[model samples]
Target chain A: MNQKTALHAFDQAVALESVGTDTFCGRSPEAYANMVGPYGGIIAATLLNAALQHDERQGDPISMTVNFAGPVTDGGYQVVASARRTNRSTQHWFIELSQQGVVAATATVLLAVRRDTWGDTEVSMPHVPPFESIDRLDIGRYLTWVKNYDFRVVQGHFDPGGAIEDTGDSLTRLWVKDLPRRPLDYLSLMAISDCFFPRIFVRKQQRMPVGTVSLTTYFHADRDSLARQGDRPLLAEAHAQRYSQGYFDHTGKLWGEDGELLATTHQMVYFKD
Target chain B: MNQKTALHAFDQAVALESVGTDTFCGRSPEAYANMVGPYGGIIAATLLNAALQHDERQGDPISMTVNFAGPVTDGGYQVVASARRTNRSTQHWFIELSQQGVVAATATVLLAVRRDTWGDTEVSMPHVPPFESIDRLDIGRYLTWVKNYDFRVVQGHFDPGGAIEDTGDSLTRLWVKDLPRRPLDYLSLMAISDCFFPRIFVRKQQRMPVGTVSLTTYFHADRDSLARQGDRPLLAEAHAQRYSQGYFDHTGKLWGEDGELLATTHQMVYFKD
Candidate 1:
């Protein structure tokens, strides 16, 4: 779909009667490219949108788990969501995504309320270069689209490397924000989130895209902090659970404009080495 | 390890830990397994454990996302979990897994409180066979050695297929219980939560193993719900998300006696058809 079309569709999807988390499961057309090939992140995030709408126990709707069911064939599909329990301490929902009349993906979502206390702030955040110290690497694809973001190296090259604790001390710290001309939004949150791949591969010179196996994300904080980035980007860090059998799971922490963290996620992905 | 020794260690681990969401960053021998061949359900439960310990806002924790990280290997590892925002309308956390001093896996978790109202309930739980009607299908390599317990699928068949969801139905309600029978604990919850693959192929005569790529789980209630009767089992209904590119994500929901919704999970898995 074209930009305007995609945007219109996104808006429609967001407003659809069946789109919200509290509603029954319904698949968005944006979940697919053609039909069979699923847009991994989009499908997963859309599911998140479906569950958070009803999560009552969670102080915030911040985390989700999804399973990729089929080839994401270019066929239209529907999403259905239900809950097993709505306990006051926790609310859990079960969702099934069907494509071509078959279950394509299923997920369970957990959300919790926030308890803010100036707890023991003993564990210090990782140290990395300042956002302004480095020149942003452009590896084609989405370079112009990324001018609004910023990052610092904490580990690997800023490319998608799904390797867990490699032998090297490769790490990255990114500060992401939109250009003054364009502000940020939920889609922007996902857009910057989509950029974590390169930031994860900081030690490398080339960019590698991995077909993620699964993704778990938490959006616990507000985006206001990101709005204050000025010329800087958000600070983000990612780590691989491990790399074995051609698949890997990685988790990341996305810090808001302040030193406080905004969101976090763990992703299982497959990469072509 | 001897049962006494293992039990002692487990108790110590549970004790050394105060229930802080940050402390939920689970680092343990089990954490190592996620790095190298850890079963998907186990990984999901571990991630949930941490999210529960940390969440401050969203009432309780709801929702989870598990994407494939690496091939399951054999090794012991540790996990460190911390909340991105512990006091939000909902809560989120960042967890990192390390094996042999290397980061092995990472997870993002969301927590929400529970609410039961017409505006909140959108979907109904799927149907599975009665826990008493089905038999246990021994699938796991370690299942033979009852890790202080034994669980039987009273709803679905122990065989691979015959009335299974695709062939059976959308549910599998099984009766699971600890062998020696102790108070409900996290280990028992972890051990029993794994039911998707074997249950799927159970209706058939053939035995097929679904090697999981990744797993994410959400706990709606508390650990007490897992205390199933030794005579009856939990009924679980599971279905494949889809299977192609030689990979797919599958999911299952477990219900206890009196049809109480216990827990749910999504497994990113690969099954050799």
Candidate 2:
């Protein structure tokens, strides 16, 4: 029964709008704009959609940590989301967002109830080259949040259009989704774990002022493996482990087009030339 | 002047004790015991030493996330740590840690001020084979927090004691520090980023029922590279991406001894049989 229409602009930029008990609100529609606001993975999937429309949510979202701390001014804000510690199989959240009253972003989810234990992965899952052999990143006509998802890359290149090489390492790897397709829930895997690109623009070779101050995903699929990934296209990779002083520390993972391992993000960005 | 005796027991097990104005009061030191609480890296270095004795702390700690949310009963414990957003080059905290009043644990630091621009370190730092030719983890007389650090491994092996093999991945790497030594700061680099050893006991060998429910460090060195790493041994590694339905996600890094890149953790554990 998926029918919201007008191509679900990311379920209308992470819907929200509850307004009171534990607050909610969210806004920001120029179809996911971003260069300063809106689109830190739809503000971390609208603060995990205010803890997935909390009625004291308690099960699925194994971990999250946002903290963009400021910037997000394309209209309303508010959020809140509390559940501070429930325990039985686990639950704990904090969530903030604020605007006219200040705060501007902060999260800390944890929900749980997952069980059937004893599994394992231990990294390893980077072997791209499908997704119709690459070629989609038309930089979304100059980055308006890259036209709300649908990347493709398969390897580094945040702008390998003209000049800029030295890719010494901050890998990329892509293949995302939600551009006209919208199904893999948990708010589009928390906005594709903040859509990569900004490990100092895939490790030096130009591109100054960056952002992402703090993010941390973790999820690892559930909700029936995200409704058996209805919207497909997942892959993802990302790298970076220290860009020093002006900060840097990405680390993505995503996967799941059979390979599974749904999420593992991490961020700390904040660059400058 | 480093004199606190008993080799300062990991700096009095992450001292804290201020007691007011943004709270403080830590405790836990049965030499850092675990199996339930007290050594989640000394409760994440006493919540990053309550945001480093917040006087509105302003720089360093480039990211933190904590969130153990339950089990921390070894003694006193009250942390608070606020400064929600101080900006002007980053600063945002919101710790928790309670006890008799509940809460248990929660963090979110960010602090900044760093600058010196254009740096790099895209991962690669697992050369190992040094720390005086390995061999040191005696499992610390049955785990009282592995006798407070001094690990050494050089490659995977949480207990490879015998028939377990299958180490195809959950890599570990080691060479840690602080066993009667004490100079590096930022609360012993946030207690050596939770010291390692639980990538499901270094991949599938055995040792079920794990814990760590949420953690996320970032730090990338500063404070004169942690006072020139004065206590020595740093190199770390850690791995893990999916452990499935009962949580699991690691991602470590640490390094130093010239190769730099100081901190970059990430966690979300909680395993079972």
Candidate 3:
């Protein structure tokens, strides 16, 4: 297929076919495959998409929490999204993603109709050079999903050798966008929230087995604001708080090119030392 | 009832009676009442207690996310806790709370058997005066639930008149413990994770109609460590990130008296101007 006619890899990966009422079928594409299964970001986005495409969906997503119950195998999977409760301005959803009749992931999404209100951003965006000023770090050698995004690291680049000897913090600030530059939307924004390398790898200075147990993202920007962002690279930063008892959690923030806070995300991850 | 014979208010509030396999009956106690409903913290703890009391519970709680679907009335309720998936060392649960046949809240909890590992706390505990040195703040006149916890504010005390005109940040640092000094456990820890007053009250300096849409807490301390804390006050701190589009989010941390990081929580709330 010609470049213009070809579908974006992300769209293909998260695409779902409606099979029944409030139910959809999806598949894990090879393009976004990780070492074991698929990239978690794609799985999270796919789950959110199930609710976003629901016939009874009321408003834009405000908050979503996706729990990785188990490893999703490479094959066909089914998503069941149900609106457990609906109010005048808000709706609550319970979504489940299963493969071969076994539950793999579950998510709870909160959608609401937001209005203009007295607004403020307490946290300021980090100071970083323009996206064009930094060189793109090629990480496609390690993970196939990394090839789908263009990453310009401003700090906390994953260095195996230097990380062990140097006592540096686990803070990664980067400029990233889709490989072919897709427009900024809730789906893409959801995927970008998990695009950061596991903070343990950067903190311990060594590659270890890590999996996100649960992830929560809150959208601050509305539909119109996100659409105005276009395909610009968002300024993203993440940092870890505590690593104990074989678990750690990190909080992240994403900003538009004009420094508008788009979304904030948090996740608890399990790691093997 | 005598003091020794009487059950603690918190214990009575979160008490549940098993009805069937994985189903339990609970109630909204008048002691823990909020302005509109029971405190969100008590509801979250009650849900966690269901899983903890389940027969199939595998390990301690690592993380939990509770979404408030609707206003729970002041009366009896039912909770259904299901182990959606169980792995060797990890288990996932989906819990639902209903009142009069309508779902009022839902939660997803992750439990795992954690082993000793290399540990570190990236974020340092904020320096504050000892709990004994700070003066106690009595706020029971505004909300009934405030009577359950003894609070000592070190900074960011809620002031209506001063907050309206003074331009300051929304950061609350306090030392708090159960009013009757109960032992610290997973259930009480979960409840304490959400005891902070709404960050907006501190930010906007005015009490508006605000509700928590979703709450997530990650526990870093193990059962032994929490048991060691026994009836001691925890140094808690909370701060907001962004407030826009009729929504806001806050990140909080709770540390033990010995500076051991215990839990980290994040919540997204809905607010009216």
What DockQ number belongs to candidate 3?
Answer: 0.86
lDDT of 3 at A147: 90
Give DockQ for candidates 1 onward, in order.
0.03, 0.30, 0.86
Clashing pairs in 2: none
Off by over 4 Å in 3: A1-5, A160-164, B1-5, B160-165
Per-residue lDDT tens digits of candidate 3, residues A181-230? 89988999999999999998888777888899999999997988788899
Task: Work out the TM-score per prediction.
Answer: 0.43, 0.34, 0.97
Judging by lDDT against the true structure, name the best candidate: 3
Best by TM-score: 3
- List model 3 lDDT by residue over B141-238, tens digit each: 45888899999989877865453543568999999999898999999999999998889898767788999989999999898889889899999999
Docking class of 2: acceptable
Give the TM-score comparing model 3 with the true structure, all chains together.
Answer: 0.97
lDDT of 2 at A196: 84
Regions of model 1 farther than 4 Å from truth: A1-39, A53-59, A73-76, A115-122, A127-139, A142-155, A158-170, A178-194, A198-209, A219-232, B1-273
**Model 2 score (lDDT):** 0.81
Stretch of 10 with least lDDT, candidate 2 chain A:
A158-167
